[model samples]
Target: MYAIVRTGGKQYQVATGDTLRVEKLKGEVGETVELSDVLLVADGENIRVGVPAVEGAKVVAKIVEQGKAKKVLVFKKKKRKGYRVMRGHRQMFTALSIQEIM
Candidate 1:
């Protein structure tokens, strides 16, 4: 079975044993987190979709890792005036292993 869940303002499709990185979430490695914002659930030919979210439906996941994504550089330059600016950023993320959908 597979489920569509929402976390950190983003949506993700996940199935049992699947690992994916999402926006950083609270908790340490090995901690179980329940995603209650399940948008849809599918099993073979059966499908259940929510108007906003399926009531009582949730996805259970284990936190595998907490990390940051690759740095993104932002640069700005102005001609003749000799103005320049640069910045770098790394977005934090949480790696989750889908355990079950219920």
Candidate 2:
């Protein structure tokens, strides 16, 4: 079975044992987190979709890692003005291992 769940303002399709990185979530490694915003669930030929979200549907996941993504550099310059700016950023993320869908 697979489920579509929303977390950190984004949606992800997950199945048991699948791992994915999302916006950083609160908790340490090995902590279980329940994603309650399930948009859809599919079991073989059976499908269930939600009106905004499926009531009582949830995805169980374990926090495997909490880390930052690759740095993104931002650079700006003005021609003939000798004005330049540079910045770098790393987005935080949480790695989750899908345990089950219910």
Using TM-score as the measure, the top candidate is: 2
lDDT of 1 at 64: 98
1-102: candidate 2 lDDT, tens digit per residue: 999999989899999999999999999999999999999999999999999999989999999999999999999999999999999999999999999999
Off by over 4 Å in 1: none
List the candidates' TM-scores in order: 0.95, 0.96
State the lDDT at 3 in candidate 2. 95
lDDT of 1 at 54: 94
lDDT of 1 by residue, 22-94 (tens): 9999999999999999999999999999999998899999999999999999999999999999999999999
RMSD of each: 0.9, 0.8
